[model samples]
Target: MDETAHALGASRTLWELVGRRAGLTPDRPVLLQGDRTLTFGELRDGAERAAAGLYGMGVRPGSVVAWQLPTRIETVLLSFALARLGAVQSPVIPFYRDREVGFALRESRADFFAVPGTWRGHDHTAMAERLGARGVFEVYGTLPDGNPGVLPPPPADGTAVRWIYWTSGTTSDPKGVLHTDRSLIAGGSCLAHALQLTSDDVGSMAFPFAHIGGPDYLVMLLLYGFPAVLFEQFAMETALPEYRRHGVTVAGGSTAFYSMFLTEQRKVPGQRLVPTLRLLAGGGAPKPPEVYHAVVREMGVQLTHGYGMTEVPMITMGAPDDTAENLATTEGRPPAGMEIRIVDPEGKPLPAGADGEVRLRGEAVCQGYADPAHAADVFDADGFLITGDVGHLRETGHLVLTGRMKDIIIRKGENISAKEIEDLLHQHPAVADAAVIGLPDPERGERVCAVVERRPGTDDLTLTSMSAFLRGEGLSVHKLPEQLEVVDALPRNDALRKVLKYRLRELYG
Candidate 1:
């Protein structure tokens, strides 16, 4: 371990880490977007100016500010500015519309909301106005700037809840998961340590900056003093050039990203997609073993996947040096500070190799959800977070995720709540009962499948029609079911008349 890197990681707050990294490597490039680059020193200076501007606009410590911006250099600057002010910030996914955006703003009680105006043909500012969002401001091309001297002292405490991240609601509204600077740092530390990166290793952020992985990846850059290319909109052809230009040594966001790269790699057989690329690493969705083997075989790069969520940005990550079998099959091992426990239905600890619920306890875990009632249900008696994921720990310390207890489907690395779709399906006049389950998919990781019981005298409910109905109900395009099955009745357990989703999976998987 580098002593200076270790000391810098011990910084109290995100702003502190920024300052320390800037001091250590002021001239080293930290963020690269297109032809532009922001050095570590520029990151610190720009954030301070933005913070001053935010302060001039009346943003103070603990002020709730929300942003729905793309993965851009300005977005990173704005977020760090919020950190500099100790403002509680909420980041909404760029693709999320009025439904999710409204919920997040209302739940976080955001006093201010920053948007990119009209972006990619979507009128974000107009939509913000339509949603009656507070403090709506445009932050594209240019950002708020003022004298750094006008700003108040940076936040001293790193333990304060400064971030509210939303989880895709399974049966209800999205839950606001609270996080602190320390937690974010801890999560990023795990990722940096596991990857064994050096200052020379270039990375790429193909995912949304609003995603939890944003801070987690940034922390790695800060720790190792390496630069990363940012992609505002990532596609194989367009993104490849940026990766090549920046010489991105590490890339990938999830299983979907892996497949995308693989598809691009297949465009021309017996050729490397990017000469400098060496590793394809990501989490947030299950990485099929075959995908791992394919990437290693064809792309000639190490592919390491991990397990993470909104509550805990990084619980475990596959190390680059791990055994190929472990890398392909397991979600890797937790770092020194993380504790992974397999528990029975009653919450008793299960021995290694026993498949059970996956529970986690670590500094990286978020403080809890903003809603106290929801938080109460998520944490176990011993303060371990009940992840709602079913997995078993190997004696070798790696974790094997089997399934999830939550009624949510992960499709192409995005969480789509089955209950949300099922509720919508129940509203259809032709549907007497509905159950939504995720079926194994080669390309998508999992594809949403709706199995419905048709009402008496109703027939001819097709997948296309069902999807159209869902779209009419305001469901996101990603959440629309790709496969539909009209059945006589749904399988129900003997108790409580609950639809057995596992049975549906068995029948349709």
Candidate 2:
């Protein structure tokens, strides 16, 4: 990071960071949408006005406010206003309906709720009313405005738990992960440092701003004094114009995003998809080596994948200057002060290069879950957060994630990493995407199943052909998939488009 950004990242609170950046570059654009641009001065001044407006509505310091708004400049203003008031804010994904929204409001005991009215054909205000939400209000393109004189002093303490982000509730009810301002700033700082971005770079927020990544990317922008284009609804075709319009230099959300851009590039083989684009960086799902190679070779861009979760927003990130072998095969090294330990099943620390559960200790780690019931299983006795992810730290300090603990397929007491088989399957020309899952088998306890999405116009892939390909790739016989199912498209979440494995298991099992 540059000297100015390094100084800005030291600001105690999110509001303080905003103030520092605004003071330095008041007129520079911080956020850009269709035709609207919000400068740093506007962000700070607008947030203060909104803070006073919220104060008029009975929102005070420590009051819990929940919002389910889309990725717009208004959303950023409201969130920062809450920060200025020192209120505990709970940000719910706009795509979440009654169930998840109700759960968050009830669990957080929110004193106020903000909705986008009707977004993407869904009446969020009506749904909020149905759930009996308190202090429900609409903040689509407008926000409550009042004189800054009505607002009290901004928050000074950065360690207080002031943020609650929910996990994607695919299988069950969502869990509210707690975070403080300092932790979030730390997460964003590490990410900004690793990517080595500067003020000259124009970024894009293609994912939901309500996700944990929202503050992460925002802090990077604040620290670097750069602007990012916001996409309320992101699709490759729809977002391409915005990318070109704003001259987006750094773009990506996850592996799925890279693949989507690659698909677009394939249409016009030699032409640059987004002429100004140079780097693709993101984390949230596993990145296959083949995807990394394809993005670099075909799209002519540097693809830097990272490893992170809701609990810790930026664990490890691939740098732009990393070696090809390291970038393709491993997630980059953790930032300074972020300690990564690979531990065996018994919780003993394993040597470097040993595959084990990854544990982390860092300033960026979340304090704990909102529900104390879920906290016990999240940390080890040593105080490191037990990231159910299975991975190893190489001697070179790179992280090599194999798969999640739950993703392991145990067939007749032998463990098989679904990622290992999926990675190999991704190399198949006829296969566009694949998810390997284990289904119950009466005789063998569990049988390996491969669910695939065929490439367009490619020949159908059968179990016979897949097995032969796996064998030729040197996969063991026992690890070979016993079943194969092809689907037109794999189920994915709205934010990052990670393959929903649980959904596949429910559908195919």
Candidate 3:
């Protein structure tokens, strides 16, 4: 967070690119976790020190370092630290299980890794030990015996990768998307300018810093010279006060996270709901109509929805003053210098209003995947990155995502996305979270089965209550789950978001 760090360099590497913003407002609060707060000056110094520490370790530039630590201020500092040295830093989401973590460690070819002695409910050292990395930093309360390895070369060309982001891998293996210095600045500038961020903005970052939204928010905040207040865990009660106390104006996250915040705000009807929040941007899934209305009606906060994936991230994003229908249903048109197309199964572009595989061609589209073989499969002959999503552009030119081609449930010859049924069930007040999957069936090839996580402590929620709720929501009789498993919590992958379709098929079969 050095107020004058950006003045020290002239290049657009992530280090210099983000530092420019630091000089503009170095004393601003850039990070806050629990009681630990670091201003822009402090954050910059910490990252520099962490970079120095890595440099001392002999971590050569252009090397890959996969760090798995919780969402602490230290994690954020280490990211820019690695970036400064030109080592492509990759973070394993703190909650990722062994299967997800192991895949990324091997796939990314990590040279150095940092993990806690213990985190949440798992042992970290044991996890990294199995991966056989060259170097490891084990720090929980303390790690005096950590290995500091060789440093890599800084960027000689703009084409060199600054970082590698892996897709969530809901239906297949994760693809490592290589992001260059130009792409980072392109994305960072787009997010910063679109959100109307300035040097005065104070961002309360509560999303998982490991994901695109969290890291993207931090980079954009730095590009705007704004300070971000980081949160280790997202809870509505504690989050609101930090925003009001810090005079935070911008909050960036998904609608699911915002829904939880608004749910908690209902209990305290005070001055801090939307106190001074000027910008709110949502990624991942768009907010449902009911949740979208609640934010506007109750808190008077307007939120814009954005759409992106790992390969061609940030394809389309809604504007701040966009209409309600746009916010609830579709993400806005593609950004400048980007062309989006609705394509048939054969990769031919379709006319407007026809839903097919969504594809993008532009500077924002990635160079290719980390692995050449995998790249050949997902990338097309013409070079457009094929997003597995199925969507169509309206007559107005806005994109409306209807379904994901891979997420389709193959039953009764009906193509359906799990999202369609999940969105329907989410309308039920008694339902906290729900996941739909195709299960084995005797007559039909497969049947719809829902693994639902009811709101905590709902012993009195009878099956009759759920049935009536689904009936009212107008869910097709065929898509209804024949049997519902009311569990304590939905199973989540390393991403810490619910996707139990893989597990659902296992159980029902």
Please, what is the TM-score per model?
0.97, 0.82, 0.75
In the predicted model 1, the residue pairs found to clash are none
After the best TM-score superposition of candidate 1, give how far the Cα of residue 107 lies from its true spot, in angstroms. 0.6
Question: lDDT, candidate 3, residue 210?
Answer: 76
- Candidate with best TM-score: 1
> For model 2, how does the per-residue alpha-carbon lDDT over 1-509 read when each residue is reduced to its tens digit?
88999998889999999999999999999999999999999999999999999999999999999999999999999999999999999999787666568889999999999999989888988989999999999998799999889888899999999999887322235678899999999999999999999899999998889989999999999999999999998888989999999999999987667878888999999999999999999877656688889999998999998988788999999999999999998989999979999999999999998999999999999998898888788888888998778989999999998766655664533446687788889999999999988776533436799999999999999999999998887565767899999999999999999999889878877
lDDT ranking, best first: 1, 2, 3
lDDT of 3 at 418: 65
Per-residue CA lDDT of candidate 3, range 1-509, in tens?
A: 23232232224576665465566567777776666777777766667767767777766687788877777777777777877678887777676656557778888888888887677666788878876766888744432222224334445565677677766433435567788766655655556555555677777777667765556677666665666777776666777778888777877566556666576668766645757876667666534556666766766777776776656556777777677887767877676767887889888989999989987787666677777876656667776777778889988778888766567554432334567667777877767888887665433435667778788655545656766776666444545566677777777788777475667667666
Better of 1 and 3 by lDDT: 1
- Sliding window of 10 residues with minimal summed lDDT for model 1: 166-175
lDDT of 3 at 42: 71
Best-to-worst TM-score order: 1, 2, 3
C-alpha lDDT values of all predictions: 0.91, 0.89, 0.67
lDDT of 1 by residue, 168-262 (tens): 85664788999999999999988998888898999999989999999999999999999999999888889998888889999998998999988
Between candidates 1 and 2, name the one with more favorable TM-score. Answer: 1
